[model samples]
Target chain A: MRVIQNEKLRTVLSYLIPFVLIPAVVIGGIAVFRSRGYSYLIFAVSALTILLFVCGFDRRKTGTRRLVLVAAFVALASAGRAAFSFIPGVNPVTAVTILAAVYLGGEAGFMIGAFSALVSNIFAGQGVWTPFQMFAWGMIGLFAGIFAKYFEGRKLRLCVYAFFCGIFYSLIMDVWTTLWTYDAFNLPFYLASITSAVPYTAVYAVSNAAFVWLMAKPFSEKLGRIKLKYGI
Target chain B: MTGFGSINPAAVFAYFLCVTVSGIFTLNPIISVISLAGALLLWAVLPVAKNKRTHIYPVLLTLFCAVGNPLFSHNGETVLLVINNNPITLQSTLYGLFIGIMLSAAVYWFSSFSLIVSSDKIIYTLGFISQKAALVLTMALRFVPLYIRKARQINGTQKALGLYKDETIITRFRGGVRVFSVLMTNMIEKTIITSDSMAARGYSGGKRSGYPLFKFTFKDAVFLAVTVFLTLLTAVPQAKGALDFNFYPHIDITFYGVSSVAAYTGYALLCLCPSVYEGSDRLKWHYLISRI
Candidate 1:
């Protein structure tokens, strides 16, 4: 029997699962672990497990070709970060992730984005924050993939996506920082965390926009060429 | 990857899980200090973290976490200072210090972990879970250094051919994009060829075998037991309410009973075991060399 695969279902599940599941899991863990240290670990691990399950699906496209393309993007994104190590917030992971999702598929995009964060954190330093990072980047790719048609060809649209995704990344991370700071969330503490994070979030957004504006068009052109040349 | 690195990946993973989880969950200021000290010492002694002058970032971050908490969070009883009519409470300030130490310690532990467990170990460990994932991770990890080298070589060739000028910002940008395209094309094509070659070799037909590099030994077992034992020792007191720490309303720790002291000692040993395990080997080796 053929495995159940529906594009629309995949799209809907991809978008909905992360939004619904992560918060639910965190809330669940907070009740059990009391939003303390063990709770954060449990919270992050649950998110990664759920996200990985979502990504662990068989694709009907060019098969291993998609994985290779993803590998290329992971390397490109990682090396881009390494190459541009001078600037603190400037990296092409988000743009490259979006471009990959747009060109390839959401599954590959999520895999590449999440895997890049996993592998790169080897050098960048891994922590309890790692799973949170992986989920954030993966969701960014998944979202980019779902909205690919609208943003792919347009430079302005791509830049806007990158900037917002960048802010979104920081915002997700800020939630983790908040949980870590107080062990659980209260309205005032979380708001304080968000406000404190505003400066860094702005930096992240601007850097993302600057990189996407410079790189997305040319990178997409190259991605298209490879896709055509190899029937990928 | 020897000495402390020789420990089995599973054991290392367990050690980190216990220490990091316990460390984060309990904000006992004493435990935080010990974790910070142990982590910093391990980082300094780690073979791979030699060029870590970038440690200034974590130091600054630690300071920021320590100082910044009081400004935004003023939910404590004891007023430490009043800056701009905002009462900076003692609880928040101390809490901030605890967080700063936790973050800094976590950073050091992470650096040391990265150094000890290279990608091959990750691949080897992951092989047991899912072969397909392990293979992909291996390929991606291998591709990174390879692609970086090729990109550098291409950049050199482009420079030599005078195809791209490095003088102006726009020229450099144009040149970088062209180089990036070429690199992507080469890497992706190479990946396809490699996959094809694997297909020809009947890669999917047979179960792939990992190298017998890492084997869990009795020593690993003992080390693992010690870490778990320490964690269990700490857990007993944590259950007994001796390890409780409150930060928001007021900075308070439970009474330092015999159990608390035992827990602190156990936690310290747990954190420092890696450094001692690695350092002791060096000490013996150096003593022999000096004798010779």
Candidate 2:
């Protein structure tokens, strides 16, 4: 018997099922456990597994060379944040996330940004804010992906783009953090936002400039060669 | 991959069912502790590879959440420290810690469940969902990195052509936007092409048969039975109105009696036993494989 199978049909189903089932299963498990603590852990683990599995499939596409590249990218993207945290006024996360978006597109940018945040948080610790952080960083990557389309690959342009991306990233994340923890339309919100804006914004600008200046040209050129070679 | 301890998807489904039913009505500390211990024991006993450092993140998060709670809200009795002329009550902090711990435990257990249960099993259990929908969900999950790789490749190409310039803030912003638009356009085009391919294959015509590699065995029945029993036991505290939740005045537990705590503990232990059995069997498989 012939089974009717469509690539698109399968693709659609694949995406939808995990998105719905992941949250559903997690929420359901939380209810049974009656502990929000356990539920959040499960959510993080599940998301991580799903992302890793997806990356594994991607590995099959181009063999070990590409797999290594992807892994390196993820590792750098993840470690970059921690390193940035140490810098006097640098926020590597915003810079890297923005760079991922500009180069990778929305889905990949979102995944890398979110996954990097999630993975990094293992050191930072997991909490209710884990998801929020993931969403925030993920948005940065997504916007970058959307934004990357307009820019031409030039050193001067990249530096400027990275700077603004940094600023946007800090502003958006600070707003989200404020909303999540604090009440709306209040003094707390105003104080939290402004206070966070200074350090975060300054760090973001410096980091963006540093990353764009250092990596933009060679990285872009290498990526271009790979595309031509693969004809993808 | 064969001979690894098998997990019954049905049992897992039932376990989740039980958790959902019980968790909504009460946040039972005893149950939470029991579940936490059971999960930890299973993790310890399981044949799966261990990464102890990975545990740090969850722990840190719990502490952060617990400590941060007081900074936001100030309520409850039993004052402890007076911070900046504000009463930092012992009750509130303790309560916060308890909630944080419970939340962390729950998250850990869920993550454990994900590790135990494979996605294939998830698909099998959720077979009732339309094939089209299922396919889409899996594809999206699968596509995250693929899209990233493609976007990066495109960006690299643009840079090589000297089309990209990093100068003024506005110019860079403009360049970034241009890259994104191109990527999005490509994605849309690819999506349409994929959709067309699906349409041609009669994807939406009617019902589709599912092909599961494994069949239900007697072990599955036994597993389901055990999980169902444990699920019921976990739910008893909620059903009997014995489960207590105190957000203030120091986190305290007054179980119906000693019997309830014992029963909960026993049930939790029973829930954890199977992982041991399965894990051992998996170890044997690995041993044989290595020898071969």
Candidate 3:
């Protein structure tokens, strides 16, 4: 594993790839390609975004304990998803991700969320939806990490966040289905899709809140102890 | 891992990626049908587990997409029905059918992909980008089964101690949660020990390289070359609008010129590539065994 030796180049590349290059691919495909078929472009962009997030995690000089903890969190989240598979649209993945982000920081949160999606899908089945799932959950974790201060000791706010993360995940997935189905974001089709998915969204959102309400304190206490004991 | 599955994971990944992506993005009914049929054919040829319910999801999805489209988008000239003063146009319905086929085709392709490209291959593919990400993924994959086993063990211990009950849904749920919390504490504590042992073993001591389980051979190259060539054959003319299709305002399909004809042929052959390869390989083996 060759670490990027130059700090300046690593920073520039990280910023440039996501902000500059990815948008260019989307804009350029839409503009120059003129919609012959750009669903592949959507797939590429989502996949590349996931790759970028993973790369961002890799670039950090994380301690071994932290790395192993990230792996454990991913396993836990995936196990939660698997355990709750009997119930449709109900999983503790989002709750676990938010907890991890709040405790382990944003990068670890993203890794757990993204890899949970990936690893669970390995058994549940991968599809066109897999990348979007990765992107959506990864972003939820990232934002949770970014806003960890507001969530500190505020279980109510955390529940609200988890609830919205549910809706956010569904809506993001709707964006993919619309784009994949129509090759364009046809508004009527998009709205219809969302309307059809409303029940799923509601169930998942409520479940997320419930899971957070149940698990937040225990997770926080356990993670805080581990952090203090191991200096992770 | 013989025949098609034996190919290098990277090449196999590329093949599925290309085939599924093209199958998905194309809107033409002819192309969609071809892609769907090709996917089913490959799936039939592959040694995949199947039950009575195997076809249910894709069938339901196809039907939903077919019926769901015209209910929302009332475009096109051919009015099939009128519902609440909104016209259900034939074009929209047909578009829905095509889109459904396209989506289900991608679904079959992915199902086959999962069967072919196992998790280790997925990790191998990921290793190309970020080794640490791959390592994390590997460790996480390892931990899932271990945690599941540990969770079961914990549940058993609780049951043995008469501390667990599952007579009702609430009790079951509570028991599961208790087990999960216990597992979390156990995992966190074990994580420290695991990391310490890993560091002692020089897990990240210096530049680490992965052991190569797969070598890209001549078959991989040939496989990739054929896939790329066929993709270009379809994509080039597709870019030139030879495969352009319209269904909203009117149902219009591109006239098959020489290039478009070749493009369609290329796509059909590309879709059949896997099944044909597998079938011929089996035939060759049969003949070799007969001679022996």
Candidate 4:
């Protein structure tokens, strides 16, 4: 029992160490660089390196085969994001991000959605909205992790949850944007909410339904298989 | 943005600090325009060219805000038109545009800043905090995507089990609630498991060693110098009452002539640094010729 416990501890340490360290190095380096008036290049390169390292570490731990499956799921999710734009009153990114959250578990889903946004936005060009999108999508993933218990093997409940998450995520993102862009106290609450919030919600709801219906099941099962395969 | 590849992180940080400070105190049109131009220049030089389309959405949003502000709230002095017994003032619309432009510029600046400064940098900068606290924050940041992916998978499984057949919106809503409940439960379990794993690894101790990858270099030093010079230039005058002004009805300023030139030069230099340094010799010649 002692030996087994020791082995388990070692395994846990291996994983947790990187998890703890990566953020420290990156954030610290950025602060130092900023204080010193270092270029944005250092920041960008460092960030990219950390992300790649994290993804690589995750893949290595989980097994390459499972990593491929997650990658595929992410790609599908990305495509779903693209498709959402075509549908009136639907936000593909929000729907797909929510679905990815549901199917992949939180961290993977967040990474997939965030990475997809990051990579895709590269083609679209990075703007102030990228971080917001990343944060919003990431929140969807976080919620997924938080909410994963009640969703265990239940489809209808999962769909319903996803829809709400979709709407909620969109609403939160819109509110943030409004706060950042507009003066909240001075402006009438209803007006700001109506102009910015409503339109996004309408689109988010439609996209949530469409994407969830299309890819949720197969992807979920695939993620399960991958999870089991790697003993995650 | 091309030159962002070489520009130091400190300069970018200083730029962000300046913008944020300027924004809080004076959100006037001229200040916004200058800031906007600065942000645009930064964006232009960054490697963001790889993803140009994403740029459009923000521009569209800016346009929407500009147009939307006038149509809704008709307030202010300089009247532009009267419709349906309501006066449309030029001041209000222009003010709206100014606000819109400021918002847009701020947004773009943040985006550029984020792109340059990743989550790692955030953690690194906040290194003085205890490792446990940092770990939790990082985990929270990291957990978002993980949770979303899991929720998505579980949702699919539930749907397949014929749990989503009821078509009514209310039933569907209930069904959604049920799914969320399940997802939440699973997330708790996962969090517990992760926490256990963390604790087992002896994470309860005091400050751990810093991240391995972060190390400063000589280039970093040079970057710091430039950033300091630029920041000081902007901060001294702006912090004092010397650089105060407004843009409405017409461009008005107390600081005219040399002061204006200095301000413009400082801003222009910041904007042009990346371009002048990064451009090819031929492109540099062309730029010089254009300036001439």
Candidate 5:
């Protein structure tokens, strides 16, 4: 009874910790960044916050079976990036990760998303930008997982969600780019980047939506069956 | 044996961590250019290039980074050109190029860094944190290329079987989707099968241990110290505002003294470690073989 209670407490803490920590970290980072104009410490703090969230969530919730499945999903997502290398901004990684989160578990989605970025960068080239990619994709998967039930059966809704995720991914990356390019995140530079990135963002959105639209039926059919079989 | 690849994983990680971080942090023209040159040198020395054409990605990325800044940002006093009634200033353009160089150099350095560390080393690094997660991440990264090949095979087989013979664009798209779905379903089943096998073999039996490929060496220790030292030398000048360069209102660059020059040279050496290590080793090996 004590063991079970301990486990339940850990589960609740995993969810609760991020809820409290994320806002506090964001507010603190913004405050520092605002005051300092530019600081490596600011970037480090935000990245640390995300890394903390991922590690904490993984530590409490994940098990061997789930870990293996997450690995496979991440591998599959990375392969999607490689397969679509010629097609700029179109990869099924995000869509597949979102669907996995919805069906398997949210944390699983987060794991898959975060792992996929680091893994894909092995082929795409890893850099200072890697942690940012991990954070961006990880958060996307988290949100998708959180709202998984709403997107479970609704294909169009899920496609729309994936589209937004694509734009969001690019937007976050652009913000990172600006920070890297200009030692500071100047509002004017950021705005200029966003305007220039519109076409690229659109391309990303369309490919993401297309993949989700095409992939949802067959991919989810298998996933739905697996969920039924494993009861995961 | 003293090649960059043969160095201790920890030392390689330390060196890469130092240069890449410093590269990302500093944006002075002198520093950025030194970083770019170092990066280009490393790329030239490293055997990452299979085809020369593939090198265009870095070139184009660098070019875009360097070129894109001036076009969008219309800051600075010295007007160079007026396009579409917009004034382009020399100061902002130069700043843009500086940024581009920094970005490009960072990109190149990272490319080599990935090769230097590799995935197993990454797993090893992560293993210190969580054994299970590291193993899983390693396995996933390993599976990516295999799945890519499988994807291509599935794609080719579909085409050969008259699956994607649809002439219309939409149907072709649908056909492509069908292939992806089939591919994913097949792969997922395989994943489940593998997991089932692992479970049957008692995956949760006890603690797991890897092959343990990396160990610290005396040379690596020395290299690690040098990397730390050079990185510090580079940082000191920046912290002192000696490497500061500004644009927007007008270009203002104030050089402090010999320390700034030392800082630039230090960064240059920091970036060149791998190439120097690899290059000198090759030279010595050739000389010894000739003597023999």
Candidate 6:
């Protein structure tokens, strides 16, 4: 099942696919292939970006326990998504990813967020927006990890962060819809999309805050205890 | 996995990739129709259990695309109607229809794609790039169901213990969160034990290799070659801008030469390959049984 046999070529491609080839497709699609509905190309680029990060995580030499821990976080987040599937635009994936990132680091958080989207979409349905959703959720976790210090023990700040994550996720998905439907970032159409999505966005933002406020204490305590007891 | 699913996943993936990329990029209504028909045909031919409800989303998506575009863009000369001092032109509406067809075609293609390419196939494909990510995906997939069951168990325990009165929606949600929190702890503890056991078994101590689940047979090669050839046949014309379609101030399709026809044929054949293959495979099985 090896596609690229040579190690050097594989490494080069591992980097090149994400950085060079994907960007070229994105840029070239916009500049040259605009009328051809290049939004799908943008979708491909987003998907590839997630793949690049996953590959980067793969390349890092981590312990087996840490590997398992990352996988567990991903599973928990997606399970959270499945649990809250009845609600539209409200899920604990962002909160769980934030908590995981706050404890594990930005990289692990990103993986958890991205992989949760991929894994959950297996049941919830995958579409052009899958990559965009992954990227949005992954970025939420990444920022949460980066600002872990600010968010730690400050439940209000964590809620605030989750609120913004909700907004960010919706906005990013709207960007995808606009690009997908119109084939360009048509400003009027994008604004129309945002306006139409206002209700969902509000629910998403409020629910994210609620989830964070509810889950923050339990998650922090559990993760902190596990870290101390098991030395993960 | 049977019928179309029996084909090497890589080959199926390649076939879908070509069909989708070319189908969307061609931007011709005629070709879009072919693609939509071909996608629906493939869905019909796949041996997986068919669900009536599953067809609704693509229909709604197509309708949304068709109706939504004209509201936003006011291009073309032939104005269909005037609403709020804005003209809904024929060109924009038709273009929207084209976009809808293209998108729904893609949606159908990918839906069937997910049905054919199961999680194991996905892992096998991802294993080429990064075995670690594949391993994580495998583990995470395994854990999702376990955590779900664990959450249910924890919820039952909490109910039995009279921990929280679950009368209202808020209480139920709180109860769910409590179960989720418990599941999180259980998951972490179990993962640690699993990792420990894996470490004891000398995991990651040596070069890792995966089980060879699929073989690229001669049939696969032939299938892949045909896919590539058809793709190139269409792509050459597409790259040359021979299939350029415009839905702006005017509706124009300039090139209708032999090459353009060839490109359309090539795309149609590429899109139809899977369905045709699946149909033939089913007929062969029926014939073999009848002979027996």
Q: Which candidate number has the best TM-score?
A: 6
Alpha carbon lDDT of each predicted model: 0.74, 0.55, 0.83, 0.53, 0.74, 0.83
Q: Which ten residues in a row have the lowest lDDT in candidate 5 chain B?
A: B46-55
Residue B134, model 2: Cα distance from true site in angstroms: 0.6
- Error of model 5, residue B255, in angstroms: 3.8
Taking the tens digit of each residue's C-alpha lDDT, what string does model 3 give over A1-232? 2234455775687677777878765664443234434676777777888978777776778899999999999999888788777677788889999988999888888888889999999878898888878888888998999999999778999999999999988888888788777777789888888998999999999889988888888988998888788788
lDDT of 4: 0.53
Instruction: For model 6, state the Cα shift of residue B80 in Å.
Output: 2.5
| lDDT score at residue A205, model 2, on the 0-100 scale | 77
Give me the runs in candidate 5 sitting further than 4 Å from their true place.
A1-50, A183-196, B47-50, B54-68, B81-86, B152-162, B257-262
Q: Which ten residues in a row have the lowest lDDT in candidate 1 chain A?
A: A53-62
By DockQ, the best candidate is 6
Q: How many backbone clashes can be found in candidate 3?
A: 0
In model 1, pairs of residues that clash are A37-B25
Ranking by TM-score: 6, 3, 5, 1, 4, 2
Off by over 4 Å in 3: A1-41, A184-192, B160-171
* Candidate 1 per-residue lDDT over residues B1-292, each given as its tens digit: 7678889887898888778766776667888888889888888877674665658867897788778888878889999779899999988888887788887787778777777878777767654434455566777778788878988999999999989797875576557667776787687678778877777876655534345457778999999999889987876676566667777686666776798888888888998899998899889889999999
Error of 5 at B192 (Å): 2.4
Model 4 chain B worst lDDT run, 10 consecutive residues: B125-134
How well does chain A score by TM in each candidate?
0.78, 0.64, 0.86, 0.63, 0.80, 0.88
**Candidate 1 residue runs with Cα over 4 Å from true position:** A1-47, A54-62, A86-88, A147-157, A184-232, B44-49, B52-55, B160-163, B167-171, B236-241, B256-262, B283-292
Predicted complexes: DockQ each: 0.27, 0.06, 0.50, 0.06, 0.33, 0.59
> How many clashes show up per model?
1, 79, 0, 93, 0, 0
Best of the candidates, lDDT: 3
Q: Say what the RMSD of model 5 is.
A: 5.7
Per-model TM-score, in order, reads 0.82, 0.55, 0.92, 0.56, 0.84, 0.94
